[model samples]
Target: MYEIFEQLLSERGVTPYRVAKETGITTATLTSWKQGKYTPKPEKLQKIADYFHVSLDYLMGKNSSLTTCPDCGFTYDPSYPEDIETHIEQHTAWEKAVKEFGEIYSDGVKCEQIKAENRKISHDLSLPLEERCEAQIRVLRCLFSRSLVANSYSLDHVPFDTYVAMMLNNPSYRKNNLEDDLLQALIDKYGTASGMNSGTIYHIPNKSKAISTKDKRDIKRDLDRIMEQLSNQEYGPAAYDGEELSPEAAELFRDELEIALKRLKLINKEKYNPHKNKK
Candidate 1:
């Protein structure tokens, strides 16, 4: 029993000082037990067993079986030699798998914590909107660059021109003219670049260029479409021809349309007067 206790301590690399501190057992009692001069009380034995995560019978030398299977929670008996070997092997594999899983779980927790911190930083309202947007763009660029590198591919292999062509050729992608213009500019700059290094690809010669005629026309077209849709809704199947809406529904729709029109006016003003708010 004393030898088994000593072996457990050795396996865990725990010194007597640590064992005494952790289990609240005295050094004198441990020394006496090691010398075969004293046996611990049942309560003390239980404390020691619990601390070392071993069964009391195993600690007391009454059970000289292999360690309990971590999977099945059963000790292997020598009486069934063949079964014992297989059980011990399975227990060993289970221990290794558990240790590996613990490491992976720890890494996953750290990654989630990092993502939360990044989200907080990215969405901070005090930062200028342009600064925040640029920061997010840089992060996205880094992620895409790293992904390409890890896959042993280059920008040439999956050219920005190809994506732009696909988007421009698809009517769904052309629905938002502002986004389409931005995508076109990006494709023009980086479509033929050898790699995805932002420093090399993002150096446009005319960063302050005005919105093109096509973009202006597209914006007007979108505004006209919105007004047409709202007009249709006002007199569509939901309403009676030449009949006014109920007062409540009329007020609700009026307020919503007013707000939407104000937003559209603001966007139009901003598009034409880009320097209006600049110092």
Candidate 2:
């Protein structure tokens, strides 16, 4: 019984000293309870149980579940929901997909194919309970990534990866559509990973994968090309147009374009060139 109380305390992030201080139970008494040296008095047990939102039966190990469910096969949580068969089914589906798709690609691939793979492996494959939980998380993460890419234009101020992870972890997050409740939970957890407005997230397309560091390099290359094109446009046409801009027009253009030029200069100055600075 006291062992149960100790487990609950750890789960709730409560220190024995804190519990002792709050309940006016002595440190030695709490220590004894933890070591199974003494069972707590009824009133003390009640106080501890109430504080932890656990039943006395749970605290005393009379019942194994922290919250009992008749249908759940397990006596303990495995980091996924119990009493919900869908959770287990989801794990099974993910394991099937993994066996079919290989490691990284399993999550990003099409669900129908994944489901098919799951069918193929249905007779031969069996994951341990912990591995099943991890597989579910992977599938969920992939699904979330795809959803974010689909709606990236509408989303505001959310990092692409965090948003995807949040949606996957949330049980009530709907498939094929972003939910406000899920978004709110994301905001709460990540506290605005982007600078954009909150409501704008709805317009963004969901992405299938996170923006890799290599992708950032590609984006930078594209931007550099655009900058070159713009610079050539601003300066090259004088040689091509068969006439140079008048001094006054050129001066006006330079002044008007000063902000953009400065921006380009900043980008050039800060750009990280891996080839040039090899370790």
Candidate 3:
């Protein structure tokens, strides 16, 4: 118990002194706990748990309940009733999806031939911007040898494992529509809000997990905003006029995409996934 308390303090980057100051747990009380002279009462444990935005069970040294689903690879706890419900549901969906949509696993491999070609392209430094963009996309396809080839020609090159699917932020309706099954699968995989707050956490939108609106309004709103932002977007010669995009520019684009995705209700803002139903 004392070890768990110490771990919490350490993980939060706070000293026992700071914890005492902020949580109003006296130094003597904490010291007693540290020495294992006394077990912390429920009230004290509650305060500490609340301070960490965690559960009392967690403060009492309970192990995380999360386990990875074999089919979807999403994490959820069987202990939580809600998790068990959604767990079985998603697993079933994914089991069916495997046969229906097929699978594209991400295996990070670089062929020597492709690697040399990429190197040659980089070393040459005189390729047209359009050419470079095309080359980079090709590189994307090559790296993910099992890239999905069903959808759009260019987009088929964009492969995904669970992580990549989790981070999908394409604002284009064409991309989203083409990748409808993919998005649905993601929603199905990380669908439950059961283990979010008090159990194991999965970072995703409240709107996504426990759906607030059955209408799915947020998705449409976000799509509209994305369309507005990228109203005239098209295939470009390069990421920039004549050079690869600058880090700042790239970061800004990422930020915009993240904001849109979250607003679109595909991500969560906090460690506590409090939302309760699926969108």
Candidate 4:
């Protein structure tokens, strides 16, 4: 437990002295923990977990997930659930088949040769452990090669495994939108908010009303003297861009723009079927 704590602290770039200062624990006690001189109580362990924003299970090396679910704040367990075990086993078998496919796609290997090999392997659905392992190697290699192609096209790091997973999960969508140049541009123009935050839709006014008529009328009497003084003077704009935007207005506007763009693009893409005319 002490070793795990030390490792986690080091990984997060935390110093023992800094942790002691933050947690109100003495440096000597923290040092003792690192040296295996003392075991922390439950309360102390809880404090450590809170300070690092990590679960006690992670601190104790019992789980590997780095984040907790925002909705329930439940700590993520890296271990697969019992129900998903069968799915995982099936995926493992698929991986074995992919290995041989990868070998053929290697730089020196001919594409025709690899295609032939893949066809032969595909015919044999009842694969033994040895054949399955070979297939997986090829699949992994092919996936890596495909990701490399994406990386070369765009000067960005694309994880091979992530690409492969996406392809398997949504074959048609992945094929259609494999190398999306618009994604980064969209994220830059509008921000990328994930999960529930991304789902939120907000409304914006057609035109920004600096001050509503009622509010403006109420303030007119107060500013009557100043209004006369400034009546003749030409002011380019308000003190700070026509009155500072409210926090809610800014956040809602931000959310609205992103939601609108994403929604519109998806709708347009779905409605426009190029194959319809041909059919």
Best-matching candidate per lDDT: 1
lDDT of 4 by residue, 198-268 (tens): 11111111122123222323343344444333333455421224554455554554456445544554455
Q: For residues 127-174, what per-residue lDDT tens digits would candidate 3 score against the true structure?
A: 654455444334433433322211111221222343233233323322
Which predicted model would earn the best TM-score?
A: 3
- Single out the weakest 10-residue window by summed lDDT for candidate 2: 197-206
Per-residue lDDT, model 2, residue 200, is: 19
Candidate 1 per-residue lDDT, tens place, 197-222, comes to 22212211122333332233344456
Q: Give the residue spans of candidate 1 off by over 4 A.
A: 64-279
lDDT of 1 at 233: 66
Count clashes in each candidate, considering only residues at least 3 apart in sequence or on different chains.
0, 26, 9, 16
Instruction: Give a tens-digit lDDT track for model 2, residues 1-279.
Output: 666667777766788889888878888888887777787798988787766765566666663443222321112332222222333443444444334333322233354455444433322236443343334444444443344334321123234355544444444443333335434444454443322222212223222223422233344455556544544557564321454555565555455555455555445534642222331
Candidate 3 lowest-lDDT run of ten: 149-158
Worst 10 residues of 1 by lDDT: 196-205
Give all TM-scores, in the order shown: 0.25, 0.24, 0.29, 0.27
Every candidate's CA RMSD: 28.2, 24.7, 22.4, 20.7
**Per-residue lDDT of 9 in model 1:** 85
TM-score of 1: 0.25
